[model samples]
Each structure stands twice: as C-alpha cells, then as structure tokens.
Target: MSGRIPHVIRRVGAVVGRLSVYVLIWAGLALLMATAVIRFYWGEITVGQMLLNLVSVETDGGGGPIVWIGVLAIGVLPLLLTVGIAALWQHVRRRERRRRGHDVRPRRSQWVKRTVATALVGAVVVGGTTAFATTVGIGDYIAAGNSKYDLGDYYVEPSVTGAEHRRNLVLIYLESGEATLADDQLFEKDAFAPLKEVTEAADGWQSVADLQQTQGGGWTMAGLTSTQCGVPLKGVGSAAGNGALHELGGEDSYLGGVTCLGDVLDEHGYRSVFLGGANASFAAKDVFLGSHGYSEVKDLSDWRAAGEPEQSFRDDWGLSDGRLMAHAKDEVDELHAEAERTGQPFNLTVLTLDTHEPVHVYDYCTVDTQNVVTSVFFCSMTQVAGFVDHMQEKGYLDDTAVVIVGDHLKHMSAGDAFHEQLDHHDNRTVFNRIWVPGEDGNSTLRPRVDQLNMYPTILEAAGMTLQDRAAGLGVSAFAPDVPAGSAQAMAPEAYADLLGSRSARFYAEAWAGGDAAR
Candidate 1:
C-alpha cells in the first residue's frame, strides 16, 4: 500500500506540473499573438497612449456586441492554437517513448524541469519580439527630442487687431472620419458623396486630400488637442504623489501651458459651447474644454437630463448622429439668438458619435451598403451634410466659418473589413474642409498638411491672423506668409524628436503641476 501511495503521489505531482506548464505556454503565446494583432490593427501602439487611455473611465465601458465578438475571436484563437500544439507535442512524445520501450508514465521531476525550461524559453522569445516590434513601431516617437527644431519658445496667440472680422465659428469634429470615406476606390460604394458634393459646390471651401497625423495625432483626444492647440498631448513622467493631477486627472493639462483655439475665442469675447453625442467625461473632454474657456460642455448626461428618450441611448456611445444633429440645430438656434442679443460671436463645436467603434447604425440610417459599417459611415456623412444645409438655410452660413475635420483617422477597428477592400490602407488620411461664408472652391492648394497646421488654418479661415501666422510648431497652410517647406514638411524623424523633446515634457508637466497645485 505504501509503494502504491508513492506512485500515486508522483503521478498527481507530474500532472499538476504539466498543467502549470500548459498555462505558462498559453500566456507566453498569447502575449506574442496579442502584440502581433495590436500591431496589425493599430500600426503602432505607444506606451503613453495606452496608459492614458487605460486610466480613462471610457476605455472599459464602450463598445457593443460586435466589438465584444471580435475581441473574443481575437483573444480565443491563440489560446486554442497553443492548446492544440501542446496536445500534439505530448502525443508524439508518448508514441516515441512507447516505441522505444521507455516508461510511458510521466516522471514528476522531468515534467517540472521540462515545464520550467519551456516557460523560460517562451518568456525570452516573447520579450525579444515585443521589444523589437515596439522599437520599430513607436521607439522613434518615444525617444524624440526638439533640439534641432528649437520649437520650445514657439507659441501662437490670436490677434483680434489683424482680423477683418470675428466670424462666428462652427467647428464640426467628425469622429474617426477620414478621406477614405469618400474614396470610391476604397469602398464598394462611396460613403462621403454627399459631403464631397457639398464641399465641391460650395465657394470658399478648401478641401485637402492629405492631412497627415503627427506623433500624438492618431487618437481622438490627442487629435483634438493638436488641432486646437497646435501641440501634442503627452503624459507626465510620473504621477506618484500628485493629488489633483494624478494619472486620471493629469490628462486635463496634457497641453497645459499651450493656448488653444477655445482660449483665443474666449479672450476675444466669443461664446464657446461644445456639444457631443458621447460622454464628455470619457477623455476628460469637459475638463479640457472648460479649462480652455468653453462656457458650456454638453454631452450624454445633458441629453438624458433634457428628456432625450431612453431608447435613443441605444448605441454604446450616447446619441446617434441623426439625433445629435437634430438636437444641435435647436442648440444652434439658441446660441445664435443669444449671440444676436449679446452681440457676441459664438463658437459652436459639434462632435459626432454615430461613426464610433462597432459602427452602430441608428434606426434612421437609410443608406444601402453591403457592409454595416459602410452604411453607418454614409449615414453619418449624410447627417453632417444635412446640418451644413440647415446652417445655410437658416442664414447661419453668411457669417459662420464652418470647419469640418475628422478628429482623427478612422480607427483601425472600425475599418478591419474596409481595409481588406482598399489596395493600400497604410498612412490613411483624415478629411479636412474649411468653409468660409463667401469664398469659392480651393483658393490655395497644398500637397499635404499636418494635423498641427489645422490650428492656425482654423483661425485663418475665421478671418483671424496670428502674430506670425504660426503657432506652436505649426504654420498655417492657408496663410500666404507661411514659408514653403515649413514644419508641415518636416520629416517623420524630426517630428518625432519634437514630440519626445524635453520642451514638450516641460509643457505637459507644467500643466499637470498647475492642476496639482490647484
């Protein structure tokens, strides 16, 4: 009985050791596979961007059934593959042992040793591959410095004296919108035809084919900050002891010392309100907007409080584009009336949400397309065009400068299927259209512009001039005085240096420090 007990104990230990090995193998393989998938989808995933987003409340909450399904598929496939390979390897090893007349029973000591060796090898492989991939993808940006550019002192301040008039500003940030939306070559059907027609026919509208993203310009919050402040949003080196500006709170001042378009408008006595179909709290948008001088930041909670039907909150994101557009029209009337009464120019910024991830199409989406995402894309564009038409019909276009731009390039998750249709989806461009009250088609054409250029371009479109027609490493692409091959033409390496510089870090930290002090 004692001899049988020893054998049973050894068998149980061996089984346990093998099981532990299986878990380690699965984890290691999953890490490698996950990195590959993320790289494929996002091109380059940065540590700072990941940390910033992970800390945000919105990161965990959003996305619907389709998103979860895709996530599960991505997550489960590697695990199953690892298990299958392990099983096959085990079977082959057993067969060999039996053919050689060796002991078929697993030895506890051998199993432990084999498992440790396999786990160690896997760890090394995973670590090496991850390091290499990150280096290739985002290392340049992370190691960037601004020594060559001397952009540390570069700052943009709006000069009301240089302006012909303070035109009312209607800035529409289309969520994950891109030029590819209108590309008939990219999609089986064009999703942005209505928008294209509107921009083509409208005078004073400048449409740019190439609007490239900078280091921090790929994500939504970073895109918004870059376009608005002419600077990239960066995280602090450490958030260990900061009370007010801790990891979660520090995002508010990511562009702290940098002056934004909203600040300029506010200083010039312009009333600014930001309306969005999603939670303004998601990226601390409300805080960012408020700190930058927006008076009212209306978001999901506001819509619900104002008696928006509970059914309308169907999307993972708050209101649908159609519903938001409808609500925006009413808000436009109120703002316009208030502007008329107070004689203050108003800045109405609307951020659409229907085109957000999982590509939820509202019940009102009538566009016919083979892909549900395409249908949603078309429907969102249609809604935007309709709003523009509404503004024109209501006489808001006469004095208002409508600046329509994608907050960022279309998120890769939103275009997984769409990418399969396009010949080359790399370096995808975001859409940009600047409509002044009375001007004809594309007076000036540039080959390409960076996201930072949009900051000064918006002011230029509003008939406002900067002190030097440049702001925060950005020269207005529309400004005649802007020298050719300015920052807009900077090489990717130079731009990365600028993003990774101490000056950029200082600016970010200053913002965080100020927030912490407060």
Candidate 2:
C-alpha cells in the first residue's frame, strides 16, 4: 500500500505539471481580454475604478454581459484548443514508441523544448500587453498621473449657505448625453432635440454652451465622483502589491473622509434621496451615497418591490428610463407634499439607464432614425421631457432647481452604435441644462467649464452660496469669474495633470480619514 501511494502521488504530480502550461495560457489570455474589453468600453479609466468595477460593480444585464462573454471566449477557447492538440500529440508519441518497442516517456530534450515554448508564450502575452498599456498612457490610468502638486492643498471643505430659504433640487443625469450629437450636419438626426425642446433656454432653462467632460472622466463612477464630490475619482495607492484591489470594492466607507454635496445638504436639514433604474450596488453607488448623506435610495430592487411589470423591469438594466421617469414623478410629488407639510427642503437625484450601449430598445421607444442609438437617445429624452413637464405643471419648478446633465460622454467602443459619427469628432461636450427659479434663463456660463464645475454650480443654483464659489477642485459656473488659477480656470492640459496625480496623502485622508492609521 505504501508503494502504491508513492506511485499515485507521482502520477498526480505529473498530471499537474502537464496541466500547468494550459493553466498559464488560460490566465494570460483572460487578463489580456479583460484589459482590452475594459479599455474598449471605458477609455482612460483609472486603475482604482477599473478594479472596483471588476470586484464590486453590477452589469447592465444587456450589453454589459456581452463584454464578459467575449472575454471568456478568449480566455477559454484558446486553452481548450491547446489542450486538445497537446493530448493528441502525446497519444501519437506513445503509439510511435510502442511500435518501436521502446519507452513511451518523453525525452529530456522534448521536455526542455516544451518548457521553453510555454515560457515564450507567457513572455509574448505579458510583453505585448505591457506595450499596449504603455501606448495608452499607463501613468494616466495608474496612480502616477500627476506628481507635481498635492491635491490636499487645493481641496476646499464644502460649505453651504442660505439653508433658511432652501429650494428643492431635481438633478437628472442623462446617459451618454453628449452635445456633439445635437449637430444635424454631423449626424443624420439630432438625438438631443426632444430634450432640447423640453428644456429650451427660451422656456427659463439655462444651458451650458461648453460643458466639457474632464480628462480621465470616461466612466459613470468618475463622472459621479467629480460632479458630487468636486474631485476626480482616483484609486487608493497600491493595496495588495500584487496589483489586486482592496479599497473601493470593499466595505470600507467610500471616501469617508471626503465631504460631498449630499453631506452639505444633510447637514443643513435637507432630505436627500437618489433614484436610478440600475442596481444601487453597482460601483458602490449606495456606499458612496450612504456614506455622504443620502437617506433614501430607490434602485432596481426598490422598483421591483413596488410591483413593476417584469417587462417594464428591463433585463438589461432594471427598469427602463420611461418607467424610471414615471416613478421619479411620483417620488417628486410625494416629496414635495412632505416638504410643504414639514417645511424641510429635499433633493431628488435621478440617473437614466437607457442610451447605454448595446442600447436596449424598449416597447415605448420608436426607431425612426437609421441609427438605433439615436432613436434610443431621443426616446430617453421624451421620458425626461415628460418629467420636466410634470414639474412645470405641479408648479414644482417654482421652488425646485432642476439640473439636467449627462453623466459622461457617449462611448465610442468598437461595437457601439454611433462610431461612424462619434469617433474622432473634435467637438465633443456633455449636454447640460440648469433651471434655477428667479434666475436669468438666458445666462451665459463660463465657456470650457468641465463637469467638475457642476458641483458648486448645482449648490449655487439651489441658492447655497459658496464663499469662493468653489468646492474641492471645481469653481461654480454661476460664479461671476473663476479664481485665476483654480481648476476651472487652468488650461486644459494643466487641469488634466492636476486631477491625474497619485495624490497619495490627499486620497489617503479622503478614503480613510485624516487621523485613521493607514
């Protein structure tokens, strides 16, 4: 029995050794595919946000799954093929050795050759991937984007004024809401026309003429962080040393040390709530909101619990925008009534999920345009328009400051719908409309102001004045003039450099706390 045990152990070790080559291949291919797919969908994403999404985020049940499917195909298919070929070769070698009446064992030279080949494959994969990452600016995505200045020096503790005369805020984030798509000459149809007509400047809505999406601000989390926190979303410094992430995806309160718009409102005795069609758990939206100040969160599960029809609860990303808008209207009415009864102000933040690519076409949307995405964008607008019309009718606009803006620019990935017109388009800007009561409807905003500026702009629109019209890294577009060297006033190149920095001390304090042991 002891002799048999040794033989069994030897056999098992041999099998593991043989399988290691295929395992290595599979791992390398999987990593390559994952990086490629992530970059394709979200260009210039931070390593922190990328890792967080990998470990914590939920998929848009529709197009989001397709990306993973493609990655799996690359990872698994090549491994299967390699294993099958290796097995066949081993069988042929065994047959030949038997025919010659000799040992079937592979020669030392053959083993050496196999080891060399496997090592070469690993090198090529790792080397090629590194080259690709470098080409795409590894520093930009990694934690070394800027090394010039400490972000802590520039960060201002967020403050709010005029709490006594607070106005309800309706902040809507439109998916892929790029103003570039509005040009009829560039594209076949103006996708933003419906939204434009609904929130026309002539109708008391002020639109930002040049609402730029900041550099390294491609994904939803980045946009949300910038707009709410007035700071760009960068990852914590190396956590595991093995390149594994441990911060953003974990239970550690998201940027617990940082103060945000929600926190300010909460401190001033405002009831804050967030509503979205997708899962609140995605990208730690709940964690961020809860940590900051939101008291109520309405997401996919909430809508489902309320008995939305299965069809209306879109498999791609929970409820459709049409359905989400309907619920938002109801939520506004309920909140407005409660506010009037209690005399406490409220904030309703809504995020739309349609127009997210592999754009899911629901029953309510019509496909009149040649590009399906265009039609989808137009349909999403109709839903937003409906909510705007509702606010106007209920006279909610009288006391509510409505801000409609896109989360980020449209993705022009390889498989996305509108690359023909969207790709390499020099003119790309996020569309934004701000409607503040008792303000000039035709107010001209600071040109070239990016999404970061929206943080303070929203505060001011709600009648909360910032001492310097600045918070975090942004200046208010509503401010008469931005500080000369502030983020909003800096040149585009310099501003990108400023936000792209590692900011280890600053982020460490922001993520953990100023006094918490690192």
Candidate 3:
C-alpha cells in the first residue's frame, strides 16, 4: 500500500499538491500587496497610475532599496512558504500512516486532500481577481470610455499673457504636505506652523483656502503634471495596444501633446530648473522635465558628481533635507545674481524629501512629539522657513513670487504615521502658501480649488496674465472668473466622472503630441 501511495503521489497527487498550493499562496499575497500599494500611494492609485509606474520601473531601476526590497520579498517569500506548507502536509500524512500500524494510509483520503486544495486555490484566484478589479475601479474605467466630457474638450493651450516684466519664480513642493497636519486639535501638534508663521498674510502672503488633491492626482508625477501642466496625469488607456505603452515610454516626451508650465515658461524666456534629493530617473521625471522645457535638472547623480559626502545620504534616496536646503540657498543666490546681471527671470523649483514616508529622523531633528513622523514634519517645515527667511534677507522676495505647496496629501499605508486619527477624517487637504511681491493683505484666492488651478495661479503670481485666467482643466484661483464649461464650472459629480473616465483617444493624442489644436 505504501509503494502504491508513493506512485500515486509522484504522478497524480503531486500535480495538485505543489502546483495548487503555490498558486493559492501567491494569489493571496498578491491581493494584500495590491491593497498595501494603494495605501502607500495616497488613498488610491488608479490603474493608469499603476501603468505609469510599471513603465517607470522598466525604464529606470525600481527606485530605492525599500521599494525594491518589497518587490523582492513578494517574489521570494511565497516560494519558501509553499515549500514549508508541502512539507507539513507530507509529515502529517506519514504520522497518520504510522499510527494505523500498517501501510494503510488510504489513497481515497489523499484524493480528498488534493481535491480540497485545488478547490481552495481556484477560490483564492477568483476572489483575488474580483477584489483587484474592484480596487482598481474596473467598472469606472470602462464607464469612463463613454463619458461625455473628455480631457481634450477642456484642455487650454497654457500661455502667459500680458506681463511686460516677468518676476522670478520660487516654487517649493513640500513632501506629503497635508493641511490636516495643521489641525492641532487632532494630531499632537501643528507640523506646518513654522512655515505658516513665516508666510503669514500680514507678511505679504496669500493662500487658497481648500487646496485639494484631485482624483487621480495623488502620486508625484500626477501632482507635478496637474500643478504644472494644468491637467491630471494618466497612462495609456486599456483600449490602446501594448505598443502604445512602449511608444509613450520612449525618450520622445512625457505628455508631449500639451503645452505645459515648462513649455510656456520656456517660450516666455524664463530659465527653468528643478532640484530634488532623489533620482529624477525614478519616474522618468528627467524625460518629463527635459522634454517639457527645463534647462537644468539636478538629482542624486549630479550631487554625487559634485562631491557630496556619502554620509549625507539616507535610504539610498540621496541628500537629507538639511543639506538639500543649504544647496538650494546657494543655488538661489547664484540664480538671483544671474537674473540681476542678465535681466532674465528664473524659476527655481525645489522638492523636499524629509517628510516622505517610511520616515527617517535626521540628526538635526528632535523628536518631541509622540509620533516621530510629526516631529520630522515639524523639522522639515523649520528647514523651509529658514530658506524663506534667507530669501527675504537677501531681498530676493522683492521680485520673486514664492509658492510653497504639498506635492500630494499624506499616504495612509498600514505602517505609515498619522493614519489612526486621520483615517476617518472627512476633510483632508493639501497645504499651500503663496507670496507675491507688493501684494496687500486684502488679496484673496477662490475658496476651493485643486492642484490643476496652481498652473495658472503660479503663472499669474509671477506677473503673467492669462486670456481667461485659465489653462488646461483649471482656472486661476487668483482670478474670480470660471469659464463656462471649465472644470471649475462643472458640477462636482460631473467633474469627478470626467476625471474617472479613460478619455482614451484624447490622451493618445496628448501623449503623442499630436493634439496641438487646443
């Protein structure tokens, strides 16, 4: 009976045992990982955003050690778990045979186990499929294809009009900058207070009251594109061929079809530049920036080449915020001097990294708050405040318009900080403060707006006038007019549906730079 059982296991039982178990474990894990990824990338990461990241990973390395390690664990741990599960099954069966005092382990029982395991595997796979489809909003993705409003219908060719004298631009992207962090009633303390104190309205600053991170606008690339290009960033639609993704991924351009902030600024003779502590290639940001119109792009490699010490780095993500801000001050000094000498305006865009999650505590920060994350946020704001103060001291603010904004709202992953109190909070928003030269304390922005409006707002703040005070899907918050049929003019539900839809043909042209009509 034992010999017969070995034969049965080798050919028949083995098929269901190892193969089915492996499938079940992997399928289960994949579901969990998908949920985790969504949480890590703000409240949700749409399918288009996932496709963009897939392209980004293939083109460049898959970002830092933390991201890569997570990927590796997903692939590797399943194999080990499957093997262990198989071993346990064999041991239990053998023990039962010994207890029976004969080679009488029934083949019928073995068949039953195989049948059960196979059924379980199938169930898991089907369940995972359903869950994944729901998580990514497959229904909405399909429905969007037929939606009446298309991105093309609303996209305005971004342009700066009527500014005889262009002021310099100092755009700062705060990492995971949520206005909720300012709610002292909820969290331990206000992390944004230092920066807020420096940018007070009496001190010649103005702010949009409820700056939102729009649907499909949570990730860095999406945020950057929305705020700069005045449109929500999306990947190729499912209706497009696989070759379409390949076409979009190439060095040609990111969103080449539309004229973006960089494009308009370049046309208007503003010297555009970007500075960040991470690898710009992580999301093909270099391609996006270069193709759009930025003259200079600075990332980790450039800093390394410039001889930054290895000790200054963390998580293999490059320099700490402290060091990056120091370099930023110097950069502003040089740019300010150059502008003074050449009479050309400049845009020095800066992105902070200290508050990015999987938070790290720098030596400069003292963790006084209950949550280390909040303390780090406070420290980061202090750094930004110092930079703002330096610009003030140098009299650079006299002509430069400073816009400090969150790239996106804070993500709420399982391991992330601040989600406990924030998880149920209905009114989460991004933080922002704007400083325009010679503005009175009385000037105010529209009560509610999204990142899209920042494009024209920034342009207008730098003394450029828009024809309708509008561009892309957004109208300037600094201006009161919401053009008929503009996103701002649409009903909330209707506007959301527009964002959720694929807009396949429109994005195709937009990605290829073929739709220049708007």
Candidate 4:
C-alpha cells in the first residue's frame, strides 16, 4: 500500500508539471500573436507608445464592438492552435505505444516530462523572436547621442517686422480628418464636399496635396504638439511615467524649451484661447497650452460649467462638434468684443471632436448617410463652414485668418467596411486649408509637406514672417528658399532618431528644470 501511494504521488506531480508548461507555452505564443496583430493594426507596437496612449484609449470611448471582436479573435487563434498541435502530438504517441503492445501507463511520467520540455522550448522560441524584433525596431531611436539634426538650427523665432500688420487667427484642428474624404473616387459618396466647396470658393485657400505624417504625428496630442512646437512628443521615462505632463514631476512644462506658435502670438500681445470638445486634462492639453501662454483654456468641463446640459448633447468624449461650434460662435463673439475693446489681437484655436474614432454621429446634427464615419464628417464640415460664413458675415474675415487643418491622418482599421469603397487608399493625406485675408483666390498645392512645417505656415498665414523662413526642422512651404520637394525638410525617420537621442533628453531635462524653478 505504501509503494502504491508513492507511485500515485509521482504521477500526480508529473501531470501538474506538464499542465503548467502547457499553460506557459500558450500564454507566450498568445502574447507573440497579439504583438503581430497590434503591429498590423498600428504600424508600431513599442512599450513606450502603448503606455503613453493607454489613457487616451481608455478615455476617448472610440472603439466599438468590432474592435473587441478583433481582440477576441487575436486571443483565441493562438490558443486554439496550441491546443490542437499538443493534442495531435499526444495522440500520435499514444497510437505508437498501442501498436507496440507496450503499456503506455508505464511510460506516462516520461512522456509528461518530454511534453513539458517541448512546450518550454516552444515558449522560448516565440518569446525570443518577439524580443529580438522589438530591440531591432527601436534600437536606433534609443541610442545615445545619435541626433543628426541640431535643435538650434531648426528653431523658429517669428520676427514680426513693424511694417507687417498682425491679423486675428482662428485655427481649427479637425480630429482624424483626411484629404481622402474629399476624393470622390475614394468613397461611395463624397464625405467632405462641404469643406471642399469652402476651400475651392474661398480666396487664399490652398489644399496641400501631400502632408506626410512624422513619428509621434499620428496621434492627436502628438500631431497637435508637433504642428505647434515643430517637434515630436516623446516619452520622458519608463512606461509607468508617460501619462499627462502634469504627472511627470518637473517635466510639467510641455515643450518649455521650444518656441511654439502660441508663444510667438503671446509675445505679439495676442490673447489666445484653446477650446476643445474633449477633456483638456486627458493629454495635458491644459498644461501645455497654459505653459505656452494660451490665455484661456476651455474644454468639456467648461461647457458643463457654463450651464450646457450634459445628457443630450454630450457623447463618450464630450459635447458634439455641432454643440461645440455653436458654443464657439458665442465664445468667438465675446472674444471679438473683448478684442475690440482692448485693441489686442485674439487667437481662437478650436479643436473639433465629431470625427474622432468610433465615429459617433449626433442625432441633432445627423447627415443623410448610411456609414457612421461619413455622416460624422458631413456634419462636422457643414458646421465648420457655417462658422466660417458667420465670421465672414460679421466682417471678421476682413482682418482675420482662418486655418482649418486635420490634426493627423485618419487611423481606421484595414478591416473596416469603409475601406472596400476606396481606390489607391495606401497613402492617405491630412486635410489642410489656410485662408488669409488679402491674397487672391489662388491655390498653392505643394507636393509633400511634413506636419512640422505647419508651425511656420500658421504664423505666415497670420501675417507674421519668420526670421529665416524656417522653424525647428521644418522649413515653411511658403518659404522662398524651400522650393517644391526640397531636401531641407527633415525625413520622418531622421526626426524619430532625434527624438530618441541623448541630446534631446538633455534638452527635455533642462526644460523640466526650468519648469521646476518657475
């Protein structure tokens, strides 16, 4: 009886060990498979990028049932494959033992040990490949002192000549809006016809044919920061520390070292206000804007405080773009009145949210379209155009420059149903239209322009000339020295390397120290 008990204990231990190994193998393989899925969906899958954007994913309320279904598929496929392979291997061994007339029970412990070894080896292989790929992908960016461009050479300082008359600026950032929306051939119907009409009919409005996205330029905060500051927004430390700028200790002064467009406007005695249809705290937008001299920052919370009903007009993000624009019209009137009283130029920057992911269409502002995304675009464009027309009707257009720009290219999944109705949809460009006060209705279509150039371009549109027609690594598209498709524009890859360099870290640390002092 004692000998039988010892044998039973050993058998139980072997089974437990084998099951642990199987679980580990499946987990490792599933993680690798998930990495591949993420990479396919979003071009990059770095830990830093994931951590920095995790908050936005949680707060934005963008993903729908389709996203969760995809996630489930990614998780289950690897598990099913692992289980199927293991079962087949076990069945073959069992059949061979039965044919040989050998008691498979006698060798059960040995077979369990072998299976555990094989599972461990499989896990190691999968994990090793994933690690190697991640290291190779981001190695150049993380290498110390490897910056190819000097920050000083690309810094843009607006030299406002006394002869140049400053104009009021109204910059509107459309979330995930793209030029493809206006391309009739790309969609079943034109998604941005209203916006296209506004651009085509208005003077000094040019549609940039090519607007390449740089590293950190694909996301909203990154896109906005790059366009405003002429630099990519990079994470400061480990994954755990990449939340809002306010949470980053001394690093709270967003782009403290860089001279942003808002800073220049502040220097010229312009009162700037940033109004967004999302929480400003989500991406530290308030911190960035306040640090950079935006006089007032208004967001969803402000809307609620101002007696706007939250239930009917607000979605997961905030108030609909329809409501935002409506509120903006009133705010613009008040700001303009104050400007008239004080004789100070005011910069009103409005960020629309209707076109954000999950593509929520407000019932009150619905367009006649089956596709939710298309409807969102139609409604947003109509509202924007109406706002512009209102400004024009009120004589605001005579001394004001209105610039409508897509913050980043659209980030729709490849598996989206909307992709079925497109032609040559590989290289999508962001939408950009600049309407200055006095120029003739001539379109200056540039072949390719990076987001960084927008920093100088916005200033130029506001009637401010750059000291050397360049700011940071971005040469203005309108600069005389920057000819069409010039090499003066830094490549996106090169800019990414700069962001990862030790010199960039040094600059960031210095900025943090300055913020701490203040």
- If scored against the real structure, what TM-score would every candidate get? 0.78, 0.87, 0.89, 0.76
* Top of the candidates by lDDT: 3
Tens digits of per-residue lDDT, candidate 3, 1-518, equal 98998898788876876676676777676765565555554445567876776676522222466566557555566566667766887798789878777576467877898799778777766776676677666767777778887777777876656878679999999988999999999889999998998999888899999899978787788889989988888747742553456655666577778788888888878899899988887777888898888999998777878898867677546677888899899999999999999988999999888888777788889999988899999999999999999999999999999999999988776668776778898888999999889897478799779999999998888889898899888899988769886778888998898777677766877776676335
Cα lDDT tens digits, model 2, 135-164, are 355656554644785677777776665566
Deviation of model 2 at 223, angstroms: 1.0
Model 1 TM-score? 0.78
Better of 2 and 4 by lDDT: 2
Ranked by lDDT, the better of candidates 2 and 3 is 3
Q: Which tens-of-lDDT digit does each residue in 1-518 have in candidate 4?
A: 99999899999998898677667667776667656555445545344445454433424323334245446755787679769867976897788788878766657766787788686667665784665357324554455345664344444444555416788899999888777777666655677777777677455576556787655566787788778877666544421232334443324466565678888899988999998877776656776798887989888778878887755344567777888888789878988888889888889999988877656657656566666678778888888888887887888888888888888877644433355643347777888887888876464644577787788778877878776666655677676456333235546666555555544443454245332111
Candidate 4 local accuracy as lDDT? 0.68
Which stretches of candidate 3 lie above 4 Å from their native place? 1-43, 58-63, 83-111, 238-244, 247-250, 516-518
* Regions of candidate 1 where Cα sits further than 4 Å from its true position: 1-43, 59-138, 145-164, 238-247, 250-254, 413-415, 422-427, 481-486, 489-493, 500-505, 513-518
C-alpha lDDT (0 to 100) for residue 181 of candidate 4? 78
Candidate 2 C-alpha error for residue 353, in Å: 0.7
**TM-score preference between candidates 3 and 4, better one:** 3
Q: C-alpha displacement of 57 in model 4, angstroms?
A: 7.1
Give the Cα error of residue 11 in candidate 3, in Å: 7.1
User: Model 2, which residues run further than 4 Å from truth?
Assistant: 1-23, 39-44, 59-71, 74-82, 92-124, 131-146, 238-252, 515-518
Of 1 and 3, which scores higher on TM-score? Answer: 3
